[model samples]
Target: MSDLNRWMQKHNLCPENILYLYRSDRKTVLHRMDGGEAALYAPMHGVLSVLPEDQFLNISKGIAVNRSQIVNIGNDGVYTMSDGRTFQGRKRGLSSHRRLRMEIGLSDTKPRPMSMSLLEKCSLLDDMPLAFCVIELVFNEDGHGVDFIFRYCNAEMANIEGVPVEEMLDRSFYKVFPNGDKKWLVSYADVALNGTKHTLHDYSPEVDKYLTIHCYQPEPGYCACVLQANEP
Candidate 1:
Protein backbone atom coordinates (compact mmCIF):
# COMPACT_ATOMS: atom_id res chain seq x y z
CA MET A 1 0.00 0.00 0.00
CA SER A 2 1.16 3.55 -0.71
CA ASP A 3 2.09 5.87 2.15
CA LEU A 4 -0.90 8.11 1.41
CA ASN A 5 -3.39 5.27 1.67
CA ARG A 6 -1.73 3.96 4.78
CA TRP A 7 -1.93 7.40 6.37
CA MET A 8 -5.54 7.93 5.33
CA GLN A 9 -6.58 4.52 6.62
CA LYS A 10 -4.99 5.24 9.97
CA HIS A 11 -6.78 8.57 10.19
CA ASN A 12 -10.31 7.25 9.48
CA LEU A 13 -10.57 9.48 6.45
CA CYS A 14 -13.28 8.70 3.93
CA PRO A 15 -12.04 6.83 0.89
CA GLU A 16 -11.05 8.93 -2.15
CA ASN A 17 -9.74 11.63 0.20
CA ILE A 18 -6.03 12.28 0.36
CA LEU A 19 -3.83 14.35 2.63
CA TYR A 20 -0.73 16.17 1.38
CA LEU A 21 1.69 18.03 3.61
CA TYR A 22 3.78 21.07 2.72
CA ARG A 23 6.91 22.55 4.29
CA SER A 24 6.53 26.24 5.12
CA ASP A 25 7.37 28.64 7.92
CA ARG A 26 3.94 28.02 9.44
CA LYS A 27 2.17 24.66 9.38
CA THR A 28 -0.70 24.16 6.94
CA VAL A 29 -3.10 21.36 6.02
CA LEU A 30 -4.43 20.18 2.63
CA HIS A 31 -7.27 17.98 1.48
CA ARG A 32 -7.04 16.29 -1.93
CA MET A 33 -10.00 14.66 -3.60
CA ASP A 34 -10.15 11.61 -5.81
CA GLY A 35 -13.90 11.08 -6.11
CA GLY A 36 -16.69 13.68 -6.34
CA GLU A 37 -15.04 15.80 -3.66
CA ALA A 38 -13.05 18.86 -4.77
CA ALA A 39 -9.39 19.25 -4.01
CA LEU A 40 -8.05 22.50 -2.61
CA TYR A 41 -5.42 22.75 -5.33
CA ALA A 42 -3.85 26.19 -4.96
CA PRO A 43 -3.51 26.24 -1.16
CA MET A 44 -2.12 22.77 -1.36
CA HIS A 45 0.90 24.05 -3.30
CA GLY A 46 1.60 26.80 -0.79
CA VAL A 47 0.86 24.63 2.25
CA LEU A 48 3.74 24.55 4.71
CA SER A 49 2.88 21.16 6.21
CA VAL A 50 0.14 18.57 6.55
CA LEU A 51 -1.04 16.33 9.36
CA PRO A 52 -3.98 14.22 10.40
CA GLU A 53 -6.36 16.57 12.18
CA ASP A 54 -10.08 16.39 12.90
CA GLN A 55 -12.37 18.35 10.59
CA PHE A 56 -14.01 19.81 13.75
CA LEU A 57 -10.90 21.28 15.28
CA ASN A 58 -10.03 24.97 15.63
CA ILE A 59 -11.95 27.07 13.11
CA SER A 60 -8.79 27.67 11.07
CA LYS A 61 -8.24 23.98 10.39
CA GLY A 62 -8.50 23.65 6.62
CA ILE A 63 -10.63 20.55 6.97
CA ALA A 64 -12.65 22.07 9.80
CA VAL A 65 -14.95 24.63 8.17
CA ASN A 66 -16.82 27.35 9.96
CA ARG A 67 -20.56 26.70 10.17
CA SER A 68 -21.10 29.63 7.79
CA GLN A 69 -19.17 27.92 5.02
CA ILE A 70 -21.66 25.08 4.62
CA VAL A 71 -24.54 25.44 2.12
CA ASN A 72 -26.59 22.25 2.33
CA ILE A 73 -26.51 18.51 2.66
CA GLY A 74 -28.43 15.85 0.78
CA ASN A 75 -30.11 12.78 2.26
CA ASP A 76 -27.53 10.68 0.46
CA GLY A 77 -24.94 12.00 2.91
CA VAL A 78 -23.53 14.51 0.48
CA TYR A 79 -22.66 17.92 1.92
CA THR A 80 -22.70 21.08 -0.15
CA MET A 81 -19.48 22.57 1.19
CA SER A 82 -18.81 26.05 -0.01
CA ASP A 83 -16.25 28.84 0.22
CA GLY A 84 -17.76 31.17 -2.38
CA ARG A 85 -16.88 28.24 -4.70
CA THR A 86 -19.03 25.16 -4.11
CA PHE A 87 -18.07 21.53 -3.61
CA GLN A 88 -19.81 18.25 -2.80
CA GLY A 89 -19.14 15.36 -0.45
CA ARG A 90 -18.88 11.78 -1.61
CA LYS A 91 -20.91 9.49 0.63
CA ARG A 92 -20.82 8.99 4.42
CA GLY A 93 -18.51 11.93 5.04
CA LEU A 94 -21.39 14.39 5.24
CA SER A 95 -22.72 13.58 8.71
CA SER A 96 -22.36 16.93 10.45
CA HIS A 97 -24.19 19.11 7.95
CA ARG A 98 -26.72 16.45 7.08
CA ARG A 99 -28.23 16.72 10.53
CA LEU A 100 -28.44 20.49 10.35
CA ARG A 101 -30.38 20.31 7.05
CA MET A 102 -32.77 17.72 8.45
CA GLU A 103 -33.62 19.94 11.42
CA ILE A 104 -34.80 22.65 9.01
CA GLY A 105 -36.73 20.36 6.66
CA LEU A 106 -39.95 22.28 7.34
CA SER A 107 -38.55 24.73 4.84
CA ASP A 108 -38.95 22.54 1.78
CA THR A 109 -38.46 23.20 -1.90
CA LYS A 110 -41.06 24.29 -4.43
CA PRO A 111 -40.76 24.53 -8.19
CA ARG A 112 -39.76 27.98 -9.39
CA PRO A 113 -38.94 29.68 -12.72
CA MET A 114 -35.48 30.74 -11.55
CA SER A 115 -34.31 27.11 -11.79
CA MET A 116 -33.91 27.32 -8.02
CA SER A 117 -35.82 25.01 -5.75
CA LEU A 118 -37.30 26.47 -2.56
CA LEU A 119 -34.89 24.25 -0.68
CA GLU A 120 -31.94 25.71 -2.54
CA LYS A 121 -32.95 29.27 -1.79
CA CYS A 122 -33.54 28.41 1.83
CA SER A 123 -30.36 26.46 2.04
CA LEU A 124 -28.32 29.20 0.38
CA LEU A 125 -29.45 31.78 2.90
CA ASP A 126 -30.12 29.35 5.75
CA ASP A 127 -26.50 28.36 6.05
CA MET A 128 -25.99 31.64 7.84
CA PRO A 129 -26.70 31.94 11.55
CA LEU A 130 -30.29 32.66 12.58
CA ALA A 131 -29.22 36.19 13.50
CA PHE A 132 -28.05 36.93 9.98
CA CYS A 133 -31.09 35.99 7.87
CA VAL A 134 -33.77 38.69 8.05
CA ILE A 135 -37.52 38.40 7.33
CA GLU A 136 -40.28 40.93 6.47
CA LEU A 137 -43.40 41.60 4.39
CA VAL A 138 -43.27 43.48 1.11
CA PHE A 139 -45.80 45.69 -0.61
CA ASN A 140 -46.56 46.16 -4.27
CA GLU A 141 -46.58 49.66 -5.90
CA ASP A 142 -45.97 53.06 -4.28
CA GLY A 143 -49.04 53.97 -2.23
CA HIS A 144 -50.36 52.87 1.18
CA GLY A 145 -53.38 51.62 -0.78
CA VAL A 146 -51.42 48.56 -1.86
CA ASP A 147 -51.73 45.37 0.15
CA PHE A 148 -48.84 43.75 2.00
CA ILE A 149 -47.30 40.93 -0.01
CA PHE A 150 -45.03 38.01 0.64
CA ARG A 151 -41.53 38.63 -0.61
CA TYR A 152 -38.16 36.94 -0.22
CA CYS A 153 -37.00 35.45 3.09
CA ASN A 154 -34.06 33.47 4.42
CA ALA A 155 -33.82 30.14 6.30
CA GLU A 156 -33.65 31.73 9.71
CA MET A 157 -36.58 33.90 8.71
CA ALA A 158 -38.66 30.81 7.99
CA ASN A 159 -37.80 29.33 11.38
CA ILE A 160 -38.86 32.47 13.22
CA GLU A 161 -42.19 32.59 11.40
CA GLY A 162 -42.92 28.92 12.32
CA VAL A 163 -44.49 28.31 8.92
CA PRO A 164 -43.26 26.15 6.09
CA VAL A 165 -41.58 28.49 3.66
CA GLU A 166 -43.52 27.13 0.66
CA GLU A 167 -46.62 28.55 2.32
CA MET A 168 -44.91 31.84 2.99
CA LEU A 169 -43.49 32.51 -0.46
CA ASP A 170 -45.50 34.80 -2.72
CA ARG A 171 -48.49 34.97 -0.36
CA SER A 172 -50.11 38.25 0.61
CA PHE A 173 -48.21 39.30 3.75
CA TYR A 174 -51.13 41.26 5.13
CA LYS A 175 -53.31 38.14 5.11
CA VAL A 176 -51.09 36.39 7.65
CA PHE A 177 -51.39 39.10 10.25
CA PRO A 178 -54.75 39.72 11.92
CA ASN A 179 -54.24 43.48 12.47
CA GLY A 180 -51.48 44.73 10.18
CA ASP A 181 -51.68 48.39 9.18
CA LYS A 182 -51.69 49.12 5.44
CA LYS A 183 -50.07 52.53 5.89
CA TRP A 184 -47.10 51.14 7.82
CA LEU A 185 -46.62 48.43 5.21
CA VAL A 186 -46.63 51.08 2.51
CA SER A 187 -44.10 53.24 4.34
CA TYR A 188 -41.89 50.20 4.80
CA ALA A 189 -42.11 49.57 1.09
CA ASP A 190 -41.30 53.19 0.34
CA VAL A 191 -38.15 53.18 2.45
CA ALA A 192 -36.99 49.72 1.41
CA LEU A 193 -37.93 49.97 -2.23
CA ASN A 194 -37.35 53.71 -2.64
CA GLY A 195 -33.55 53.44 -2.20
CA THR A 196 -33.21 55.12 1.20
CA LYS A 197 -31.92 52.59 3.75
CA HIS A 198 -33.59 53.13 7.12
CA THR A 199 -33.26 51.65 10.63
CA LEU A 200 -35.98 51.59 13.25
CA HIS A 201 -35.72 51.17 17.04
CA ASP A 202 -39.34 50.95 18.23
CA TYR A 203 -40.56 49.83 14.82
CA SER A 204 -42.51 46.96 16.31
CA PRO A 205 -46.20 46.98 15.52
CA GLU A 206 -46.80 44.65 18.45
CA VAL A 207 -45.32 43.66 21.80
CA ASP A 208 -41.98 41.84 21.99
CA LYS A 209 -41.39 42.85 18.39
CA TYR A 210 -38.54 44.98 17.17
CA LEU A 211 -37.48 44.81 13.53
CA THR A 212 -34.70 46.54 11.65
CA ILE A 213 -35.60 47.23 8.02
CA HIS A 214 -33.44 47.75 4.96
CA CYS A 215 -34.40 47.71 1.29
CA TYR A 216 -32.82 46.67 -1.96
CA GLN A 217 -33.96 45.65 -5.42
CA PRO A 218 -32.81 42.05 -5.70
CA GLU A 219 -34.47 41.81 -9.09
CA PRO A 220 -36.66 43.95 -11.29
CA GLY A 221 -40.23 44.44 -9.98
CA TYR A 222 -39.54 42.66 -6.71
CA CYS A 223 -38.54 44.19 -3.38
CA ALA A 224 -36.24 42.12 -1.18
CA CYS A 225 -37.33 41.53 2.43
CA VAL A 226 -34.46 42.80 4.53
CA LEU A 227 -35.42 42.50 8.22
CA GLN A 228 -33.41 41.79 11.36
CA ALA A 229 -34.70 41.19 14.87
CA ASN A 230 -34.01 43.77 17.54
CA GLU A 231 -32.99 42.60 20.99
CA PRO A 232 -35.23 43.27 24.01
Candidate 2:
Protein backbone atom coordinates (compact mmCIF):
# COMPACT_ATOMS: atom_id res chain seq x y z
CA MET A 1 0.00 0.00 0.00
CA SER A 2 1.16 3.54 -0.72
CA ASP A 3 2.09 5.71 2.23
CA LEU A 4 -0.89 7.90 1.44
CA ASN A 5 -3.27 4.97 1.53
CA ARG A 6 -1.89 3.75 4.82
CA TRP A 7 -2.30 7.17 6.39
CA MET A 8 -5.80 7.63 5.00
CA GLN A 9 -6.95 4.24 6.35
CA LYS A 10 -5.77 5.21 9.79
CA HIS A 11 -7.98 8.27 9.57
CA ASN A 12 -10.91 6.24 8.24
CA LEU A 13 -10.56 7.86 4.80
CA CYS A 14 -11.64 5.17 2.36
CA PRO A 15 -9.27 4.77 -0.57
CA GLU A 16 -12.23 3.73 -2.69
CA ASN A 17 -13.43 7.31 -2.45
CA ILE A 18 -10.41 8.83 -4.26
CA LEU A 19 -11.25 11.28 -7.05
CA TYR A 20 -7.96 12.36 -8.68
CA LEU A 21 -4.21 11.91 -8.81
CA TYR A 22 -1.29 14.07 -10.04
CA ARG A 23 2.08 12.88 -11.26
CA SER A 24 4.94 13.58 -13.69
CA ASP A 25 4.98 9.95 -14.82
CA ARG A 26 2.09 8.59 -12.75
CA LYS A 27 -0.95 10.25 -11.19
CA THR A 28 -1.15 11.72 -7.71
CA VAL A 29 -4.09 10.64 -5.58
CA LEU A 30 -6.06 13.76 -4.60
CA HIS A 31 -9.77 13.47 -3.97
CA ARG A 32 -11.14 9.91 -3.62
CA MET A 33 -14.89 9.84 -3.30
CA ASP A 34 -16.15 8.45 -6.61
CA GLY A 35 -15.51 4.80 -5.84
CA GLY A 36 -11.77 4.95 -6.60
CA GLU A 37 -12.12 6.74 -9.91
CA ALA A 38 -9.72 9.33 -11.30
CA ALA A 39 -11.62 12.18 -12.87
CA LEU A 40 -9.00 14.94 -13.17
CA TYR A 41 -5.45 15.56 -14.46
CA ALA A 42 -2.48 17.90 -13.83
CA PRO A 43 1.13 18.28 -15.04
CA MET A 44 4.14 17.18 -13.06
CA HIS A 45 7.07 19.64 -12.57
CA GLY A 46 4.93 22.14 -14.46
CA VAL A 47 2.77 23.47 -11.68
CA LEU A 48 4.92 26.61 -11.47
CA SER A 49 4.88 27.62 -15.17
CA VAL A 50 2.89 25.20 -17.34
CA LEU A 51 0.64 26.82 -19.93
CA PRO A 52 -2.94 25.56 -20.21
CA GLU A 53 -3.79 23.28 -23.10
CA ASP A 54 -6.59 23.60 -25.63
CA GLN A 55 -7.68 19.99 -25.26
CA PHE A 56 -7.37 19.81 -21.48
CA LEU A 57 -10.73 19.93 -19.69
CA ASN A 58 -11.35 22.64 -17.12
CA ILE A 59 -13.43 22.50 -13.94
CA SER A 60 -13.28 24.90 -11.01
CA LYS A 61 -9.90 25.90 -9.59
CA GLY A 62 -8.54 23.89 -6.62
CA ILE A 63 -11.70 21.79 -6.14
CA ALA A 64 -13.67 18.96 -7.74
CA VAL A 65 -12.52 18.83 -11.37
CA ASN A 66 -12.80 16.45 -14.30
CA ARG A 67 -12.07 16.48 -18.02
CA SER A 68 -15.77 17.20 -18.46
CA GLN A 69 -15.54 20.18 -16.15
CA ILE A 70 -15.21 22.44 -19.17
CA VAL A 71 -18.47 23.54 -20.67
CA ASN A 72 -17.05 25.65 -23.49
CA ILE A 73 -13.53 26.23 -24.84
CA GLY A 74 -12.72 29.44 -26.67
CA ASN A 75 -11.00 32.83 -26.41
CA ASP A 76 -13.28 33.52 -23.46
CA GLY A 77 -11.40 30.77 -21.57
CA VAL A 78 -12.84 27.61 -20.00
CA TYR A 79 -16.26 27.57 -18.43
CA THR A 80 -17.38 25.70 -15.29
CA MET A 81 -19.13 22.35 -15.57
CA SER A 82 -22.91 22.29 -15.66
CA ASP A 83 -22.90 21.11 -12.04
CA GLY A 84 -20.57 23.93 -10.94
CA ARG A 85 -17.35 21.87 -10.58
CA THR A 86 -14.32 24.00 -11.56
CA PHE A 87 -11.14 23.13 -13.52
CA GLN A 88 -8.96 24.65 -16.25
CA GLY A 89 -6.39 23.57 -18.82
CA ARG A 90 -4.44 25.80 -21.15
CA LYS A 91 -1.55 25.42 -23.61
CA ARG A 92 1.06 22.96 -22.45
CA GLY A 93 4.83 23.40 -22.55
CA LEU A 94 6.74 21.52 -25.27
CA SER A 95 8.43 19.24 -22.75
CA SER A 96 5.17 18.60 -20.89
CA HIS A 97 3.52 17.86 -24.21
CA ARG A 98 6.29 15.43 -25.08
CA ARG A 99 5.97 13.77 -21.68
CA LEU A 100 2.24 13.52 -22.11
CA ARG A 101 2.75 12.03 -25.54
CA MET A 102 5.29 9.50 -24.25
CA GLU A 103 2.84 8.32 -21.59
CA ILE A 104 0.00 7.57 -24.00
CA GLY A 105 -0.21 4.04 -22.61
CA LEU A 106 0.32 5.19 -19.03
CA SER A 107 -2.09 7.47 -17.19
CA ASP A 108 -0.78 10.96 -16.45
CA THR A 109 -2.06 10.52 -12.92
CA LYS A 110 -3.99 8.05 -10.86
CA PRO A 111 -7.76 8.13 -10.67
CA ARG A 112 -8.94 11.39 -9.11
CA PRO A 113 -11.55 10.76 -6.46
CA MET A 114 -14.49 13.10 -6.06
CA SER A 115 -14.73 14.38 -2.53
CA MET A 116 -18.38 14.61 -1.48
CA SER A 117 -18.61 17.90 0.36
CA LEU A 118 -21.41 18.51 2.85
CA LEU A 119 -23.27 20.47 0.23
CA GLU A 120 -22.62 17.92 -2.49
CA LYS A 121 -23.71 15.07 -0.26
CA CYS A 122 -26.87 16.89 0.66
CA SER A 123 -27.53 17.66 -2.96
CA LEU A 124 -27.54 13.90 -3.65
CA LEU A 125 -31.13 13.62 -2.42
CA ASP A 126 -32.33 16.85 -3.91
CA ASP A 127 -35.82 16.97 -5.44
CA MET A 128 -36.74 13.57 -3.95
CA PRO A 129 -40.37 13.09 -2.93
CA LEU A 130 -41.54 14.13 0.53
CA ALA A 131 -42.22 10.48 1.49
CA PHE A 132 -38.87 9.42 0.13
CA CYS A 133 -37.07 12.24 1.87
CA VAL A 134 -38.22 11.05 5.27
CA ILE A 135 -36.29 7.84 4.69
CA GLU A 136 -33.17 9.77 5.59
CA LEU A 137 -33.85 9.36 9.31
CA VAL A 138 -32.69 5.82 10.10
CA PHE A 139 -32.44 3.72 13.28
CA ASN A 140 -29.40 1.87 14.63
CA GLU A 141 -28.59 -1.85 14.93
CA ASP A 142 -30.61 -2.52 18.06
CA GLY A 143 -33.34 -0.19 16.96
CA HIS A 144 -32.43 1.97 19.92
CA GLY A 145 -32.27 5.48 18.45
CA VAL A 146 -31.26 7.51 15.43
CA ASP A 147 -27.70 6.80 14.40
CA PHE A 148 -26.97 9.50 11.88
CA ILE A 149 -28.17 13.04 12.35
CA PHE A 150 -30.56 14.43 9.77
CA ARG A 151 -28.32 16.76 7.85
CA TYR A 152 -30.44 17.58 4.80
CA CYS A 153 -34.15 18.21 4.48
CA ASN A 154 -36.21 18.15 1.32
CA ALA A 155 -38.61 20.93 0.33
CA GLU A 156 -41.57 18.96 1.67
CA MET A 157 -39.81 18.26 4.94
CA ALA A 158 -38.78 21.87 5.28
CA ASN A 159 -42.37 22.96 4.89
CA ILE A 160 -43.85 20.25 7.11
CA GLU A 161 -41.29 20.64 9.88
CA GLY A 162 -41.56 24.39 9.53
CA VAL A 163 -37.79 24.50 9.77
CA PRO A 164 -35.56 26.12 7.19
CA VAL A 165 -33.01 23.93 5.39
CA GLU A 166 -30.19 25.99 6.78
CA GLU A 167 -31.37 25.22 10.29
CA MET A 168 -31.13 21.41 9.98
CA LEU A 169 -27.48 20.75 9.26
CA ASP A 170 -25.99 18.50 11.97
CA ARG A 171 -28.99 19.14 14.21
CA SER A 172 -30.58 15.93 15.55
CA PHE A 173 -34.31 15.32 15.45
CA TYR A 174 -34.51 15.32 19.25
CA LYS A 175 -33.13 18.82 19.35
CA VAL A 176 -35.65 19.86 16.75
CA PHE A 177 -38.46 18.20 18.66
CA PRO A 178 -37.38 18.57 22.26
CA ASN A 179 -40.78 17.84 23.74
CA GLY A 180 -41.37 14.78 21.52
CA ASP A 181 -40.94 11.23 22.73
CA LYS A 182 -37.24 10.65 23.43
CA LYS A 183 -37.75 6.87 23.61
CA TRP A 184 -39.04 6.77 20.05
CA LEU A 185 -36.08 8.71 18.72
CA VAL A 186 -33.67 6.46 20.57
CA SER A 187 -35.43 3.38 19.25
CA TYR A 188 -35.35 4.78 15.73
CA ALA A 189 -31.60 5.30 15.86
CA ASP A 190 -31.04 1.76 17.16
CA VAL A 191 -33.02 0.01 14.43
CA ALA A 192 -31.40 2.20 11.76
CA LEU A 193 -27.86 1.38 12.78
CA ASN A 194 -28.80 -2.29 13.06
CA GLY A 195 -30.17 -2.34 9.51
CA THR A 196 -33.94 -2.11 9.80
CA LYS A 197 -36.61 0.05 8.17
CA HIS A 198 -39.34 1.78 10.15
CA THR A 199 -41.58 4.81 10.26
CA LEU A 200 -43.59 6.91 12.73
CA HIS A 201 -46.61 9.10 12.14
CA ASP A 202 -47.50 11.89 14.52
CA TYR A 203 -48.21 15.59 14.92
CA SER A 204 -45.52 18.03 15.98
CA PRO A 205 -46.97 20.59 18.35
CA GLU A 206 -43.70 22.47 18.16
CA VAL A 207 -44.14 23.14 14.46
CA ASP A 208 -47.93 23.07 14.74
CA LYS A 209 -47.83 20.50 11.96
CA TYR A 210 -48.55 16.83 11.24
CA LEU A 211 -45.93 14.65 9.55
CA THR A 212 -45.42 11.03 8.61
CA ILE A 213 -41.81 10.21 9.42
CA HIS A 214 -40.33 7.14 7.73
CA CYS A 215 -36.76 5.84 7.87
CA TYR A 216 -34.92 2.95 6.26
CA GLN A 217 -31.51 1.81 7.41
CA PRO A 218 -29.80 0.99 4.15
CA GLU A 219 -26.34 1.06 5.69
CA PRO A 220 -24.93 1.99 9.01
CA GLY A 221 -24.94 5.74 9.35
CA TYR A 222 -25.48 6.11 5.63
CA CYS A 223 -28.85 4.70 4.57
CA ALA A 224 -31.23 6.97 6.42
CA CYS A 225 -33.49 8.63 3.88
CA VAL A 226 -36.66 10.04 5.38
CA LEU A 227 -40.10 10.96 4.06
CA GLN A 228 -42.40 13.53 5.66
CA ALA A 229 -46.10 13.77 4.80
CA ASN A 230 -47.56 17.06 5.99
CA GLU A 231 -51.24 17.40 6.82
CA PRO A 232 -53.09 20.03 4.87
Question: What would the TM-score be for candidate 2 when compared with the true structure?
Answer: 0.37
Q: How far in Å is the alpha carbon of 161 misplaced in model 1?
A: 3.0
Would you estimate the TM-scores of all the predictions?
0.37, 0.37
Model number with the top lDDT: 2
lDDT of 1 by residue, 5-57 (tens): 45445654442243222223343333443213222233432322233343322
Off by over 4 Å in 2: 1-124, 131-148, 230-232
Give Cα distance to truth, residue 147, candidate 2, Å: 7.7
The residue-level lDDT of candidate 1 at 108 comes to 28
lDDT of 1 at 178: 51
Model 1 residue 20 distance off true place after TM-score fit, in angstroms? 70
Clash count of each predicted structure: 4, 64
